[model samples]
Target: MEEVYGFEMSDGTGDFFGYTADHLFADIWTRPGLTDRDRRLLLIGMLAGQGAADVLGIQVPAAYANGELDDEALREIVIFVCHYAGWPQGARLNSIVEETIAKAARRAARAGESS
Candidate 1:
């Protein structure tokens, strides 16, 4: 497979062209003032709006890496945002939150086994 610019280019995995992804995509993703949990929420909302489900899967689990977010906490965020952002946006976020919650549990379980 040809390494298109920096990404490991593959036809089956994804068809990202690399220019928008490599340069602009990587930079504006993780900004300051946003905790890992906050970043996860923002990304999930944006992904939902744009119908970017693939990236949502990759990011949702990351917030829980530091244990800063939990199932209940994310649920609250979803609830709060729902009141203002409307049900459609909230539903999308809720689904991703559920996915993240599960991911957090799995990671915690693995950590417990190690110790």
Candidate 2:
């Protein structure tokens, strides 16, 4: 979970979280065939197509934080996906991507200042 999402998961025991931890992240995400970057691109496209802005909000930031994507790649994804996903969804995705990059830059600036 930490590697994939750039965050830790709690040991939550319910069916949903358990399945997420034990199956989705542990089994599927860690599988050998696809790199995390490949998965992230596929997932971003799917989510953008479905107009899943909220989840994209989470995923875009995680991709940036995990170094699976960079500013240019993330920006290009918005343009490419928008062509297929439509302008409205592209608008939403663009907002999320830009905000995520800005937030990451701000965080880096803060860390540097602290150092």
Candidate 3:
């Protein structure tokens, strides 16, 4: 699998990223039960419900970049989630999704300019 996303764990983080690499990514993500697209959708919903914005900041863009989701689909998910997860959480996720999409656009524009 391609390494589409990554982050540096801080010095005193006690092997957090290492364990994530060894266990979460290397093991769980490699499991055959779900395709990457399926995993992304599941993760997006779970994170949105739990109001995990920081992780969403990473995942939302990755999902878009990898074609796991699009703006309309994400918008629909946000709307659906609002009824269950509350309006505030949905609103927060909307902002995070908007920011992620905007950043993706900027990156694409820069890549176009250089090409």
Best by TM-score: 2
Over 1-115, each residue of candidate 1 has an lDDT whose tens digit, in order, gives 1211223435433345465555544654445675545655666567666656567555555555445566777788778767766777777777888877776688879999999
Residue-wise lDDT of candidate 3 within 1-115, one digit each (tens)? Answer: 2454533434534577678767888888889989887888788888988999888888887788778789888888789878888998899889988887788789989999999
Per-candidate TM-score against the hidden true structure: 0.53, 0.93, 0.80
Scored against the true structure, residue 71 in model 1 reaches a CA lDDT of 73
Ranked by lDDT from best down, the candidates are 2, 3, 1
- Checking candidate 1 for backbone clashes, the offending pairs are none
Task: Give every collision pair in model 3.
Answer: none
Ranking by TM-score: 2, 3, 1
**Best model per lDDT:** 2
Query: What are the runs in model 1 whose C-alpha is more than 4 Å off?
Result: 1-17, 25-41, 49-54, 66-73
- Candidate 3 global lDDT: 0.80
Off by over 4 Å in 2: none
TM-score, candidate 3, is: 0.80
Per-residue lDDT of model 2, residues 16-112, tens digit only: 9878888989999889999999999999999999999999998999999999999999999999988999999999999999999888889999999
